[model samples]
Target: MQVSVKHSLPGRLRLLYDKNEYTSKQALLAQTLITVQEGILDTNCNTNIGSFLIYYDTHIVKENDVLNLFHALTGKYLEDPELLKNVDQIPETESIESVLIETLAIHYLKKWFLPLPVRTLLLWKSLLERCFHVLSKFAESKRLFSTELLDATAITVATLTGNKNTASQINLLLNIGEEIEEITKRNSYGNLAQSLLSADEPVQVVEGMDEKTVPASALKKDDVVVIRQSGLIPADGQILDGEGMVNQSSITGESIPIAKKAGDSVFAGTVLEEGEIYIKVVQTGKETKVQKIIDMIDNSQSLKAAAQQRSELIAEKVVPFNFLVTAATWFFTRNIVKTMATLMVDYSCAMKLSAPIAVLSAMKESATKGITVKGGKYLEEAALSKIVVLDKTGTLTYANPVLEKIYAMEGFTEDEVLTIAACLEEHYPHPLGRAVVRAASEKNLVHPENHTKVEYIVAHGIASTLNGKKVRIGSAHFIFEDEKIPCPESLAEIKKQSSLEGYSLLYLSHDGILVGVIAIGDPARPGTSEVIRELKNLGLEECIMITGDTEGAASKIAAECGIKKWISQALPEDKVKFIEDEKAKGHKVIMMGDGINDAPALSAATVGVAVEGCCSIAGETADIQLQKSGLDNLVTVRRLGMGLLEKINENNLTIVGVNSALMLLGIFGVISPQMAAILHNGTTVAISIRSMQPILK
Candidate 1:
C-alpha cells in the first residue's frame, strides 16, 4: 500500500492514495486509526475516490510526520493494536486460545531452549510488567492493596530471593487465569454474534407476475418476496400472501417457531421453519429487527445486574483483607514462604472473574431458549418475583377474535347490525374490529363508511352519528354504562350466557337504547391452562389476569387457564394502578403484555415480559421478549432466572470456601508458593468454566 499528499494546508491536508493499493475496509481502518492520533482532530475518507482529508493541529503534527505515518502502513501493520488504540468497535480476530498458547510457548521456550543466564534475565521482563501494573493501579486510586499489587509483591519477592523459576511460573499462571476468565465471559457474545444476518444471501422477489431471485441489497420498501419452507427471511417485512411458521430464535432468542399468514409480520434472519409466506419488505440489512437484537447483545455490559455490581464491589473491598492476612502472617511467623502463600491466594480475583461470567453466560443461554433478558437485573428480579400478572388480549388469547354470534333486537335484522358494526370497525386495528369486518367480508356484505365522523374511546368503544341519531359499539361498560344505553330485560339471560361461554361481547346501541349484541370468540391459546399449571409447579406464588373483557368472559377464561385471580373491565390506567398496588404491598410482579396500552404496566412491574412478539410485547420492547407464539416460554424464563441467581450464589460460595482452605493450607506451611498459586488460579478457572455452562436443563 502506498499513500501520498495531493494537497496541503497548515492544519488541513488532502491526501491521495492508489485505489488499487488498499481495500475500502482498509481505508476506513486507516481513517479510524488516524483520527485518534494526538494532532489529527478528524478525518473523512472516500474510498471510492481513493483520497482522504485530514484536519490536524500543526503545532503538534507536521506535514512530514503525517506523510511518514501513512508510509508506515506499507505492510504487516493493519492488525497492530498500537495503531488502533482509542478507536472503538474494531472487530477482534485473535482467538483467546491462540493468545494463551503463544504466551505459554514463549515462557517454556526460554526455559528449555535458552541457557540459564539468558533465561533468568528474560524472567525480569515479566516481573517488570507485573510491578508496573501494580504501581499504575496505585497511582490511579491511591490504594496500596489490590489483586495486581499482591501478585507483583509475591513475584518481585521470589525473583529478588534468587527464585527465578518460581517467579516465572507465578506470572504464567496468573496470565493463563486471566485469559481463561476473559474467554469464558466473551464466549457468550461470540455465540450471539453468529446469529447476525448473512447480508450477502439472495432473496426471491415478485416481478411482473413472476418470481425472480435478487440479492438482499436489491430489496427495498414495499417489494414482495416469497419465502419457502426452511428459507431465511431476508428483511423485516409484513406478509402479503401465503403462511408459514417462522423460527425467531435469531431475533427473540427463542427456538420456538411462530405461525405466520397474510397480514402478519416477519423479521430478517428468522428462518421460515415450515410452510411458506409471501412478504412485503419493510426494512432490510442493518435496519432489520434481528440487527437490533445484535445491537442489544453488543451493549449488554451496560445492563449488568445489581447483584453483579455488588459482587464486584465486594471483590474490591476484599483486596485489603488479603494484604492484611499476608502482613499478619509475615510479622508473626517471620517466614517469607508462608507470606507468599497468603498473597498468592486472592479472594478478589475469583469473585471479580466469576460473577460477570455467570450473569452473561446465563443471559446467553436464555436467548437460545427464546427469552431475551434486557438487563441482568431483570433476570435477578425474575428470580425473586412472587406474582405474575398477564395482559388478556394477546397474552391469554393469542390470536385475533372470530365473530361467533349476532343477536339482533326486535326492531333490527342481524345483517343490518353486522353491516353497521363492520363499517365502523374496519377503520380500527383492534382484534374484535377485525373479526367483525372479516365476518362481514366473508358474507359479501359491502358496508362502506356510511356513518359520520367516528370517535374512538380507548379500551371502551367507538361512537358516531348514523343519520343524526347517536350510534355506539364497544364493551358492556362502554355502551350500557358509560353511554347510558339501557339493557333490555329480555336480553339479560343471553348476556349472562355469552359471558359464561368466555366469548367477549360487543354491545351496540342507537339513541340511548339497546339495538343488538355481538358475541366474539377470543379463544385461549392452546395449552394455556397447562402452562399456568406448570408455572405454579415452578413455584409461582400467584397468577393474575387483567383485561377489559366482561366479568363472565374474564371469569371463564381465568378458570380455563387455571388462573385463580382476575380483574375485569380494566382500562390502561387500572393496569398501572394494579401493578403499583402490588408493589406497595411488597410483592414483586412480573407483568406480561402485548399491546401498546400494556407499556405502562409492563414498565411498572418488577420485570416486564413481552410475549408472542419481538419487543414490548417483547419485540414490543419488554424486559424479556418471548418471540414464540405462546406462553410456554414463560416457564423457560422463570427456570433460567432462578437457575442464574442460584448458580451465581453457588459460585460465590465455592470461591470463598476453596480460597479460604487454600489460605489455611498455606499458613500451615504444607504448600510452596508455586503450589499455592496453582491451586488458587485453578479454583478461579474452574468456577468460571462452570459458570459458563447452561443454567437450564
Candidate 2:
C-alpha cells in the first residue's frame, strides 16, 4: 500500500506485466511455445548435442545446418520416444548437460540467424542437408524431418520471384531484437534493483534520531529553532526575533538581501544564506503542500484519455492478431518453422515498446523544464485542448498587491499615516501588511524604532503600541464604529476612487484619529497583455476569466488581459461548474489556476494546467504543471503537446497503414508469405523511428 518497490515487488510486477500487451490467444500461444520448447530441449539433451557437434571442428558451431539438425532431434526426441530409444540403441553417448546446453545454444542461433535474409537462405539450405545427413545415418522410422529445413525449402521455392514475406520475416526479427534491447536498457535490472534497494523513505521517528542526523521533521508549531548558515528552515513559522540576512530566493524568488526579524514568517526548504534565526513551526507532514503534491502525482495514472485508451485497445488487438497469424500459418503450412516466422513478424513488439516509452520520456523532459505532467493521458488530452480558462488572481496578477497611491484624512499627511502604519505592520506576513511597508519604504520614511508588543488579527489587521499610543492598521470596519474614527471628506473621496479603479482599501489609525488610508489591489502582471496576444496567435481563443473578486475588479482584469468572457464573485465550486458546462458543449477546455480554490476546477477540465508555486491540491489535480508560473509555460506545453500528438499520428500511419497494405497485397496472390513477412517487419522499424521524433523547441 505504501507504493515502495521493496514493500511491493509482487504487486509492482503484476502491475508491470499487466501493462504490457495481452490477448487471450497470444498469451496461450506464447505459453504453449515456451512449454513445448522446454520439454523438447529436456528430452534431447543426450542425442541432439552430439549430432550438432559433428558439423563443427572447433567449440563454436556457427553453421545453420547444425542448428536445424539440433532443433529437429530435440523436437523429435520429445514427441517421438521411438527415436530416442533408437538413439540409445546405437552406442556410447556424450555428457547430457553439455549436449543440453549446446542444443539451447543451437536454438539461440536459429533465433539469431532467422532474421537476416541475405545469409538466412544459404544457412537454411546447408542446415537442411546436415539435418538429413545426421538422421539418414540412423534407422528409417527413427528419422525425423527438420522443421527449419522444411520452412526454408518452402521459402526457397516460394520466393522463386522477388516476394516480400521472406524478407519481411527477417526484417521483423531484426527490429524486434533492437526494440527488446532498447526496452531492456530503459527498464533495466539495474533500475529495478536500485529502486527496490533504495534506502527506506527518510522517517522522522524519534527512534531513528542521531547526532549526525538532525531530524528536521521534529520541529513543532511555535517552537524557536536555530538555522545555521546555509542550513534549511525546517518548518513554516515566523521569526520570534532575530537579526540576519537570509536567502528567501527559494520561496519569494528574491535573490537579494532579505532581512529577518521578529514576526517574519519563514517557510521550510528556504536556506539561511548568511546569518541564523530561530523560527516557529506552523505546518508539517501531510498538512504541508509538498507532501500533497507528491501524493497527487502518484495517483494521476487513472485519468487516461481517448488516445491512450485507443492505443491500449490496439495493443490488446495485436495479441489476438499475432495468435491468429501464427495459427493460420501453422494450419496451412503444417510446419512449426513457418508458424514462428509468422509470429516473429507481428507489429505488437514495436507497439508495446514505443507507446509508453515515448510518453514517459516526454514527461521527464517536461519536468526538467519545470513542468510536471501527472500522467500520459493528460499529456494526450492537453495536446487536443482548444480553449484555455484562466484565474485572475495569482495567475494573471501579483499574489501581493503593490502600493499605488495614498489618501490622507482632514489633518493627516500621507507620509504621517503611512509611516505609523508601516511601523506597526513591519512584523506581519499578510500581503496587505507588506504593501503598507513597501509604501513607507518608497517615501523614505524612517519607521518608528521604539515599537512595543505587536499582534495580528487574522483576515483583518495588526495592532501595536508606538510612542505610548495604540496604533491599529486594518480594514475600514475594524478602525471605525467603536473606535469612533469619522469618515472624513478626503478619506471618503479616496475610497470612491479606489473602488472605481478596482483597489482594496486598508485603513490606518494613530491614537484614535483616522489618519489616512492605504490602497492595495492586484496589479496587472508585467507583459501579461503581450502574452495573451501571443496565445491568440497560437490559435487560443479569447481568455476567459473566473474569479472570487468583485465584479468590477474581475471585469477590469479581464479587459486588461484581452479576455471577452468573465465571471466574478464565484466560489471554488462555481469555477468547476463553469469548466464542466463548457465541456458539456463539446469544448475541450484547459483550466488554469494556481491556488487551492482552483483544485476542483483543474481536476474537472479536459486538461488542468497549474503554474509552479501553486498550492499542493492545485498542482496535484492539474494535468500539466508548468515549471515557471508564467503564461510562457502555456505556449511551451501547447507546442509540446502538439508535437507529441503528431509523432503518434505519424507512427500510426507508418506502421498500421503500410503493414495492412502489404498483407492485403500478399493475400491477393501478388506476393508470398515470405515477402509479406519482410514487408510487415519493415513497417515496425519505421514506426518506432517515427514515434521517437523530437518535440519542437
Candidate 3:
C-alpha cells in the first residue's frame, strides 16, 4: 500500500520480468507519480492518457468506446492517446472545470493579473506558501519552517483572505493566521498582500487571455496541458488531435474555431471543448506559451520603473554613505550586527515601485476599456487637461452626411429632380455623389439605366450624360457663371439655409437651366449630447467646435451640441494655430477629430483622440483611438484617466507619509535596518495593490 520510488534491487527485476513493453502505459504511470510529487500537473495531457491506459490495459474502455468518445471529441484517432496530446490546451480542457481554472490561472493570472509591483509582491508571498507546502509534502521529518517564512506567509495569506470580503477585514484577520500576522499588520506589505489573497480566485479575475504559464523548469514528460474556450492557444503541435470547437478569441480576437485535423498548427493554451486533442510533443515543452508567460513574470522584477531606477541610484549613494557613518558607530560601540542593520534599511523598495506601477496599471486599465493609451506619460498628462476642442465633420458629427432635404426648382418635380440627379451622380464617387445615390435609393428612384462619359470639375462638381442629355451637378458659382444658368430666389434661400445648418449644397442643371438642388448635412450622433455633458462635468474648461464650413453652419451645429464657441471656415493650418492659441491662453486642450484635415490639429493638441472608423491618416495621428466611433468612448477615456490620476496621487501620498515617519524614527535610531527594508518594500507593494481597485462609472 505504501507506494514509493523504491529504486535499486527491484527496478531491473520489475522491468525484465513484468515485460510491460507498453511505452505509453509506462509514460502514464510516470506522469501520475510526477503530479503527486509536484502537487499539480498541467492535467490537460495526463487526464486523457491516464484514463485511456486505465481502460485499455485492463479492457475497461473497449476500442469502440474509445473511438466513440474520441470521434465525438476529435473526429479522428480515438484509439491513439499519443494523438490526443496535439490539441491546444484551452480547447482540449474546456469540458473539465478544474483544468479550466488551472489553465486560466496559468495563462492570464501570471502575465497581467494585477499591477506589476502588486503582482510581484503577491507572487513572492505565494512562493513562500508554495515552499512551505513543498516542505510539508516532501520533508522526511516534520521540522518547523523558519520564523521568517511563517511570518511572511501568514501576513500575506491573511491579507488575501481579508481583502476578499473587505479591505477593513484584512486588518482584523492578521492576529489569527500566524505569529507574524502582527508584523504584517504593522507594515504596508500586509495591506496589499491581504488584498491579493482576498481577491476572487486569480482564475475568475482572468476572464480573457493574460498569457499566464507554467514555469519552464516545471513542465515534465506526459504532463497534461488544459485548454478552455475563450482562452489563448498556448502550445504548438498536434499531439492529441480530437474533434472539438476551439474559441480562438484570446489569440485572434475571433469568434470562430479552427477545426482540428492532424498536422494542424495547435497553439498553446487555447480553450477547447466538445472535442479532445491529445498531443505527443513535437516542439520542446520548454518553449511553450506557459513557459513564456512564466518567464515574463519572473523577469518583470528586473524591469525597473523610472522611480525605481531613481531610488536605486539614491540608495547607492545615500545607503553607502549612511553605512560608512554606521561603521564609525560600530567602531565606537563594537557592534557589527547593528551596523549591518543600518545597511539593510537603505534599500527603499516602496519608493522604487510605487509611482511607475501606478502609471503602468493605469495604462493597462485604459487598454481594458477599449482605449489604447500610447504610454504612461500620456495618461499622466491627460488627467490635467482643461479645454477640449472638437473637429466638425467626423469627430463632432458623422462624416458621411445624409441627404436631409432636396429642393426642386421651378417646373421640376421632386421625383424629376432626384431621377435626373441620381443619373448624373451615379458615375461619380465623391461623398456628395454617394449621399445623393443613397437618397435616390430610399425614394425608390432608379439610377440611370445608361450613362455616358463622367467628368469631375475641380472646385465645381460632376458632369455626365444620360439619355443623350447633358446633365451637370455643381456649385451654383460654376453653373451660373460658366453655363449662364439663373440662380433663382428659391435656390438662393436653399443655399443660405444649407450653410446655416452645416450642410454642403450641390446644384443641379440640365441643358443650361438650373433645375434642382440637394442639401446634405452631417448630423450629430444620438448619444453625443450625453457624452459632451459628461466631459464638461468632468472638469473640461470649455468645449469648442472648429470647422471649415460656413460660419452660420458652424454656429448652428455648435449651438445644438451645447458648445459655447465656434471657429468657422478654418482650414487645417488654422486648427493647429487654434490649438496653440488655446495653450497660450493657459488651456491644456484635447482635440477630438478625424479625416486627413484633422491630422495637423490632432498632432498639435495635448491629447488627440480619434473617433473610430475615421480616415486612416487621422487614426495614425491620434494618441487614442476609440474601438467604436462614438462620443461615449470619449467620456470613458476622460473618466478612467482621472481615476488613474487619483490612484497615483493616493500612492504618492502614502509613500511620503510612510517614508517620513520611518525617516523620523531612523534619525532617532529607533528603526532597525531589517524593519526599514520591510517597510520600504511593503509600502511599494501596498501602493501597487491600491492601484488595482476598480474605477467607478
* Candidate 3, number of clashes: 68
The lDDT of each candidate is 0.76, 0.57, 0.53
TM-score of each: 0.64, 0.56, 0.47
Cα lDDT tens digits for candidate 2, 253-290: 22223567778877654555545566666665423433
Ranking by lDDT: 1, 2, 3
Assess candidate 3 and give its lDDT: 0.53
- In model 1, state the lDDT of residue 104: 93
Q: How accurate is candidate 2 locally (lDDT)?
A: 0.57
Candidate with top TM-score is 1
Report the lDDT of model 2 for residue 376.
Answer: 69
Q: Give the Å shift of residue 374 in candidate 3.
A: 3.3
Best by lDDT: 1
lDDT of 1 by residue, 577-654 (tens): 999998999999999876666777887899988776433233444778775678888888888888887887788789
Total clashing residue pairs per candidate? 14, 18, 68
